[model samples]
Target: MRKSEPGRGLSVPRTGWRARIADRPARILLLGYLFYAAVGWGLLMLPVAQSGPVAPLDALFIATSAVSTTGLVTVDPGSSFTFFGEIVILALIQLGGLGYMTIGSVALLVVQHRISRRREAAARAAFELPSPVSIGAFLRAVFLFTFLVEAAGAAILYPMFLRAGVESPLWAAIFHSVSAFCTAGFSLFATSLEGYVAHPGVSLTVAALSILGAMGFLIAVDIWRTLLRRRVSFGFTTRIIVSVTLALIGAGTVLLALFEPTVAVLPWDARLLAAFFQAMTAATTVGFNTVPIGNLAVPSIMVLLVLMVVGASPAGTGGGIKTTAFATLFALVRCTLRGRRDVLLFGHRVPAEKMRTATATFAYYIGFLVVASGLLAATEAGAAFEHILFEAVSAMSTVGLSMGLTGALSEPGKILVIVLMTAGRLGILTFGIAIARTRPDDTAAPQPFGP
Candidate 1:
């Protein structure tokens, strides 16, 4: 028996954590967040990163929010973070917004001056593009489009910032432009866009940037190509995205105007601007509120809730279930009701695989929303259900529009929110995949390709 026991060490080991992490794309994405969050937390903890010592939890919280681009901050970026720290936050926003994959590809392109097969595959996976397009071309389009829009937005905002006599107008304009286009919602002003609530130029510029970002880079590329080529045709996905976005904006504005007496009581110009800003903010998931979010009527908040949950389109800076997914689910239901064999939208059949994914995504979103809200409600005893629900939805959608409950959340509540925000940004499917225990390869052996 002793001699037989001696051979135990000769057997091969099972799969390791490294293999699991390396094999799953979702795990790579999750690990990327942890790495970035750790770096950000360390940077933010530095004395130069802040005017005073920040609690470790607060530093970690801010780092997580910034890296997720969730914008659900316990501490104000403008006051809590020093200039160096603000820059760090801005850098995190950009990194989170543009996505690490895209940024890595760009850096690779710069350093290597050639795209490797592995790099191309990584970019393709990160972007989740269905059809293969040249990775270099796609990266270039995204990079150029982003900078151009942000630059234009900054130019539009500079005069307004200067007119308002904001200290460091240039910096304010630059920061806001990046924040808006990235849909990060990190404002320099303690009151957010409240100071510019009545200023059409400022509100409009911010709204424009948010909308453009939320439209998704694919739609942007389509629009650009259409204009450049002088063609009117666009893809079905692009049509659905644009149509839903504009419709949400219009419906949200009208609903807010009707429901919120506070907004209705403003002067005609101010009233229109306020409604538009709020609508755009919700629809785009930009999270900048010109008016006091806590003062919003229940009905108006409901409208914003729906908008936030629907969120922006796929591949955009914003988060939530996404516009296309929502639309596809609607189409699927309509087809079932009509006894049709296939889901049709804009005269094209929606693929069954896409429809299934949409349905699954919707289910996952609702599941997360309910679970997060329940956890928050249990932890935050004194908070109203409505406020807790709003906070939960906002955090889960990465919309960041709070009903004044964010700053008052208990430690448990904050942890719940952090989880929701991470899930929202990483996406439900990706997060699920990362956490799922069943590894596909381990379930069964692979068969021949032809079979």
Candidate 2:
């Protein structure tokens, strides 16, 4: 008998597409968002989902926007879609806000009473959780906190909407509450919260929800442990997130109050409240505007652009380069300028890896803004440069704020914004990693000599 090869008896592991995708957490996240976007697109295309005839591309744009939680609508959602469609959009917002894996993990926990190692790994990767944080506890906290906060928001808004003579007060309350909490920014009113600009209760409640959501689930978990469980101290990450968030909101509010022409016309109290609300919405990436974005003076628009670019904290419902990344970049620049070898934030040393990641994130964001803005300018004839740039930044940051350009976007412009929103939701770095080939870490490798 011919002698068999020594290794021929060994069973080889399968390397199918599913197995390949399952091996990479980033791939799983990318595919998950895409899958949801496709499903949402299909649902929105149904006749029952619409009150009026919707074009295929517009449906796709709405689906992608909802799934990304970017809220740059080509059509007025309230008038264009039926109750079923609005429900579909709201569901997509929740899914996107929670991180797509969160719902799956929650469902698995309910059914199996445990999450698989692979699933947990994917969740961890998606959230970029630190090694010390317990995945199970974190996920449980996220679900509990999100529901509680959203419910409270809805309850508070119900009476306010009822008092406002809204036709569907209860529905409107629930929808806006969820939207605000998710930082999804979808408004039933065509004018957003402009009608409630002077209603301090409504504006403040919505702002509170947006702030809490933008602060991230990690902070919630930290708070729960420190206060409720009495097991741990407040974390450094929480401190950084809180301090930076507060600083931005305070500074933006002051600047807007002093400079925004629209706010200048309001009564003193309303002006301050309007400034605070605008600042909160921009920094939180909530995107709801109480004033006309198109009419904002150049200085005010610049302030909003800065706020939107910095955006919310890590693992938060909102998007952008993120507050952590912004903090890291600021520290890196400060240290470099001072000729210090170590990068420090609040007297604590930032890890080299974190510094590198922050730098990469900043580079990617600025680079994409330039490229996308250029393409948009090319596609949109006669549009002002600032308007085109604003649209690009808003989409890339997932801020959803527009200067009246969203509705007038050319077909190519819509496609470009769709890509930007998807990328922003996935995170520029995470998306980069998902598409790029895997490579071993070279952190410890010796540097090559160069001139």
Name the best candidate (by TM-score): 2
- Which residue window of length 10 is worst by lDDT in model 2? 1-10
Tell me how far the alpha carbon of residue 219 in candidate 2 is from the true structure, in angstroms, after superposition: 1.4
lDDT of model number 2: 0.90
Q: What is the lDDT of candidate 1?
A: 0.83
Over 4 Å off in model 2, which ranges?
1-16, 229-232, 438-451
Task: List clashing residue pairs in candidate 2.
Answer: none
Candidate 1's residue-wise lDDT over 266-362, tens digit each?
A: 9988998999999898888888989999998888889999999899887688887888888888888898999999899877899889888888888
Residue 233 lDDT, candidate 1, scale 0-100: 56
2-92: candidate 2 lDDT, tens digit per residue: 2345669655545567666777788899999999999999999999999999998999999989888888999999999999999999999
Error of 2 at 143 (Å): 0.6
Question: Candidate 1, 154: how far from true, in Å?
Answer: 1.1
lDDT of 2 at 53: 98
